[model samples]
Target: MSSSPQTGSEPVTAPSTTSLTLAIIVSCELMLMLDGTITNVALPMIGDGLGFTPAGLSWVTNAFLLAFGGLLLLGGRAGDILGRRRVFLVGIGLFTAASLLAGLAQTPWQLVVARAAQGAGAALAGPSTLALLTTSFTGEHRTKALGVYSSVTASAMTLGLILGGVITTLASWRWVLLINVPIGVLVLLLAPRHVAESPRHGGRFDLAGALTSAIGVVAVVYALVRTADHGWADPTTLVTLVAGAALLAGFVLVERRAAQPIMPLRLLAERTRAVGFAIMLLVPMVTMSFQFLVIQFLQLVLDLSPLQAGLAFLPMAAGLLVTSRTANGLLGRFGTKPTAAAGLLLLTAAAAWSATISTATTYLGGILGPMLLIGLALGLVIVPINVAIMSTVDPQDAGAASGVLQTTMMTGAALGIAVLSAIYAATVGSTSAVLVGDDAVALGMRHGFVASTVIAALALAVTLAGYAVRERQSSHTK
Candidate 1:
């Protein structure tokens, strides 16, 4: 096995100014996250314009995901080896060029290729964004910065949905991809002047580790996605699942032997950070599944248009915006453990309430309350969880740590959607049979929400257990 890097931790360089730097990094992150789901609202239009078969059209989204999810670890390690600023700018430049190509694409395949390129660019940039945030800001300022960053991350999905609906309806589906071009260009121009360069470590790339981990995660995600579409027993799904497991096993062995491991195992050893990662993974799982089910309920049961359905989520977005601004202060006063636990309790309560929804439920009654609660809960949860994760990480490994966190969030959301889709199918019965009526759709959504409640409850239980453990250890120290 290769040894850990012998380099001393880099001293935090006090930036002369943080406003411009924070804006540039946060904007880039917002763009990357927005792309993750913005295409969803415009899928029908895209399929129509590109002449895609129903099944084939999904690749337009999956291509980006596979590339982005698979390459994230490598991207983080690259930032550590190369300068963060250099890699960040290169990624932005590539993303902007790809966005232009995607907007101009006439063929389905061309758009798919462009989307994948954008994903690769995003993978390269995403970790650097978090790394920069952690490196640039320290103490109370860092906490506040992370709070705003978390808010942006939490809101980006909804914002993307809202933007996708408006843009697709008012203009064309192509503009969803086109919009990034200008934003990317602006960031690229500003990044050089504002963002500081991170110190480069001397090491060879962990090529084997990267290849195996990327392929493994991609295969796993592919299997989950297919299982959601097809049944769990599909031969293709089974084969891919097994292949993914084997590749991931190989990746572990490779990492143990590599001179400079891309993801150091030591990061997971700390109890607080470990809890942070677990919550990051599970919390998004709950939120993503909620979004998937609620959107279906709005569209299928309520017979709302894409635009209307998108607009329905605005209350939650507003609540999130308001609370995220003050999350750092809450975290400072209450601490992450208490703050996070309170948030999970609220989330659990909201999910439990959402489970009672039916065809008779009204937006103002059942839906709006849960949406607002979820927004407030998420605002409280995300910032502290982020603070907990990055609080103890060594500056030298910031890129890798950020990569791991991002990977957890993406993989969690994907898995949550897949599992929840399966639950919805099972609850409604017959995956192949389309839902016959509003009642059927409503019942299915209720079942999905019930399942989501289970997930939130589990997350809360884990949080409590982590607290108990911390208490016992503290007593021992005394």
Candidate 2:
């Protein structure tokens, strides 16, 4: 490597060691990302095996999402205070053990509990990878490492759909959870040998901030998820929403006073990072909603096998991988604002087109085209969005910023699914209607797609407006 100093303040390591570190981090991240959706394809089988009622079945996914999203800020702060490597190992071990329990679960409740444990572990481990990257590599090495990280994240999600299908098809839904055990074990073994311990800040853990924020988010997510079974105006839903909002407000107050807040308030005040966070929250909402609805449409409406439904996403993944470089080029040449705007516009169009799918719609002419567009849109926007989120933040707050971004992503996914499910339910008239006919289900899916289109259009508008403001500010400063 060249003699130029690395971006991080840490001392440089041997190239071979650096390579190993990257491998370990990327693999761990892939595992984490995969779990977010792998269970989706397996949900039907899992529900059948556990004899879950329709309402209870959603917890299989929602449990993990709520825990993971709610605790991310605390986890990132833990890495900053207690050391990233230690937290990472702890997280992997917890997650691995939880996976085993989930695989062996005898009841729906057991599986849901195990899934929540896995999410908690994931929250601890996920942010550490970014923290490790910030402190480990420098120069061209850092760029390459980050690029690989982003690509793996984008691809792993779709890969989960495929992997979930294969396992659930040939073997059992239990294998979907079981597969993670070995991967987690392998990562745990390899991590200590390759990854260096992060330097710990002597700051306090900010337990008050951690607890309040986590609980607040969990409550909000719980309320949202319940809306599928109970309408938004239900007494329990209203109470939970009010409680969640109050807790979150209290969290903000706690953070403002706490010496070592899990999330630094100052980070959110930055214009570019704030905008990035908003976009990150909204984009994932659309993508996750799309994935959830489309997969169901393929399997339920078209009556495709699990394997076929999983394999259907291959084109989308391929398109995303192919377009990633072009996205990076666009970011370099055209800038974050315009490139992101264009990408979101494409995504909006894709969402609109997807809304047109019906029970009679064929894979070739309807689904495949939208999937390709979704992939391309993902490639064109994600990296630049990351750039905007982190570019202006202080180096010392990297962990916190990363934590916030990740938290938003997970929360957005959970919220989107819940909201979309509600829309799906409304369009279908009732749960009874959903089970009555495929036509009702198809109509519900279409409604969900239209809602996602609205979300994408809003994101596109945000990108355009935020960048315009940024440009105006730059000119004024000049």
Candidate 3:
């Protein structure tokens, strides 16, 4: 295995310009993250305006996710080979053009296609955001930058919901997508001036590995999305799932043989980094599932309007922003292992607490406390885990590493939604006769939260166990 990269140990940019550089990177990251959930609150409005059928409406969101998740690895590697700043501008430009297309789209298919294009652009840009941050800042500055980045990563979805509601209510649903035009144009204009380009690593691009990985991820994500509509036993689902797995296996083989692999296996060879990747995968599973279930609970059971439900997440957003800002201090004082464990512990507890909700439960009674705790837990967990994975990577491979991290996150989100949605569906289907009305839905949501609790607990176990083993090995060597 190759040794960890030490490039991040020192700053790449001049100290005077680091803050401006950070703002640019963070703004881009926020834009990407916000898009992940911003359209959700506006989906009904979009469907109505576009005359979408029930099943077809979902494609508006799924198309974006499928493309984004599929191309992230390729995007990251492209940044490494071609130059990050250049690729980032290309991505932002494409995304801006696609956003305009989406806002102007007359048909459902056109909108879906435009959304997919936007996702492709995001895939190109997403990895470089973190790659640039890791390369540009060092020491306490890196930690602080990561803290701000993590805060955006964790809270952006909730903020997106809020923003979507406000935009859709105050203006039209088109504005939700159209709003990106100005932001993207501004970013495109300023990025070249403020963002320093990374040194391009000279290598033969791993074409074979890239094709297999991208196709494999898209196939898998499509299969998972299908599971919400078709059962796991459906022939199409099984075929796609198997095909995706085979393609991914082929990608591994190709990567291993390639002279300059798109994703170096060496990155995962280190125990800490591998564990960090696993935890990142698992934590997102819980968070995405939690969000999905809670949104349903607020809208279906509590009968809140979209705007009200979006505003209800204010406390969680506030908590995330506050705690994420402070997480760097916690990490400095307690170190990555303990801080991560504590965060996971809190996440597990919050998921469990959320699982106790019923039809009778009020927002203040069961949801508020857990939402706040979830915010705090995510801030603590995401920042340290990001530090663990990115801080140790070789600078040359930072783009690839960032891509893998994001791809893992996307896969986890898809897996979580698929798994929890299946469970909830099964619960509701079986209990439909026994329970009446909102009670059945509440029970299903509770079951989904229960599953999320288990997922969080497993992540906690892995984190603690991984650290314990490392400590034991250290003592033995001593």
Candidate 4:
């Protein structure tokens, strides 16, 4: 919350000097990133194991996401106020403890509660990872380090699917949650030896901005979820949506007035950052919906086992790995703006292809094609947008700026999945019976996928328009 120097917002000009150290830090970061999506594939197993109702099971993901997204600013502020090294260890500690609790949960409620705690831990640790990177290296070295971070982030979704599939099939769903404990322990133990602390700054935390933003995101996401259950026309849904919008607006006002703002209004007002984050949000909205919808298609419609379904997503992981590695070089040649636009276009095309898929579609025909294209598009889009957002912000505010960048994507994906799930459910029929019955839901699921393509297409327009503006701005500067 505090815009202090000691919170480690100073830029990293020499990550090369500490390359080995940063490798360890990046591993720590990858662990956190892996946790975000790893549990996604394991959701079905966890629900069955805990005897959770369909609606009840959504909380396993939503609870963790809401807490993680809502509290990210607080986490970034903690890094600023508490000192990055101290806060990093604290976050690692909290997340590790929560992982153990989640692993041990015997009931559905217990699991949801534990997941939320784990989210709290994640929120704290996640921003610290970026802040640590900011202080760990500098200059062109910083760019390279960010590229490394970006690739890890790019592959996170697919990595989670692969890991969850193998682990859940080979071991138990609990192992998916339990996996974090060992990673966290390693990070907590090694963080101090490799990473140097940023010099401290003086200020109070932006408590007001943090609270309103968190509540606002919760309210909005809740409203989206309500739309699924009650339909979009329901009074409760409308009221929650209105309330969330109002609270988020108030959050803006609060940040404008606060001496130490968690999110700087000025940064958000930038055309590049705003557009970039919007594109960032939309990409996940498309992909996460694909995950929720398609996974069902795989298991129920295609009759694949959890392991098979998980393994089926391997192409996505492979595609991301190949494309993400070349992204920086692509960006260097094409420029950040054009590269982002191109990526969005590719993503929209992938969604278009994905929309054509159905329960009757073969793994090769329907699933693998979209998964690979989507993965490649993600590798292209995520890195540049993330780099743009973080790079545009003032170095002193990197923690808050990066926190918002990460939070928007996570919240959007979570809320996006919830809304998409409702759409699939209402249109396709209840998921429970589809598994046992004649599978009448395939038609509806196909329609849902097609409709989601509209979102990606719209995002493409936004990306194109934004980049055009950037091009004009560059021309003017010249």
User: Candidate 3, which segments miss by more than 4 Å at Cα?
Assistant: 1-16, 47-59, 106-108, 424-440, 469-478
What lDDT does candidate 2 reach at residue 354?
Answer: 94
Tens-place lDDT digits, model 1, residues 1-478: 1122333355424345468888888989999998877876676567667776433455666677667767787889998887677788888888889989998999989998999899899989999999988878887677667777888998887787778778877888889999998899888877776787776777778889889988887787668657645768899999999999999999888888888998887788888778878888888778877776676577667767767777888888887887677676776666677778888998999899999999999889899998888888888888777767776788888899998888778767766666666566555554232233667667867887887899899999889888553221112110
Report lDDT (CA) for all predictions.
0.77, 0.79, 0.78, 0.76
Alpha-carbon runs more than 4 Å astray in model 1:
1-16, 44-62, 104-113, 422-440, 469-478
Q: Write the per-residue lDDT of candidate 3 for residues 340-409, one digit (tens) a residue.
A: 8988998999999999989899999999888888888888788778777777787778899999898888
TM-score of every candidate: 0.87, 0.92, 0.88, 0.91
Q: Comparing candidate 1 with candidate 3, which one achieves the higher TM-score?
A: 3
Query: Per-residue CA lDDT of candidate 4, range 209-296, in tens?
Result: 8888888888887787666457789998899899989999999899889988887777678887888878877888888778766776
From the highest TM-score down, the ranking of the candidates is 2, 4, 3, 1
lDDT score for residue 63 of model 1: 70
Top candidate by lDDT: 2
> Which residue pairs in candidate 3 have backbone atoms (N, alpha carbon, C) closer than 3 angstroms, thus clashing?
none
Task: Judging by TM-score, tell me the better candidate of 3 and 4.
Answer: 4
Best by TM-score: 2
Model 3 RMSD vs true structure:
5.4
Once fitted onto the true fold, the runs of candidate 4 whose alpha carbons sit more than 4 angstroms away are 1-17, 428-441, 469-478
Residue 392 displacement in candidate 1 (angstroms)? 0.7
lDDT of prediction 2: 0.79
The TM-score measured for candidate 3 stands at 0.88
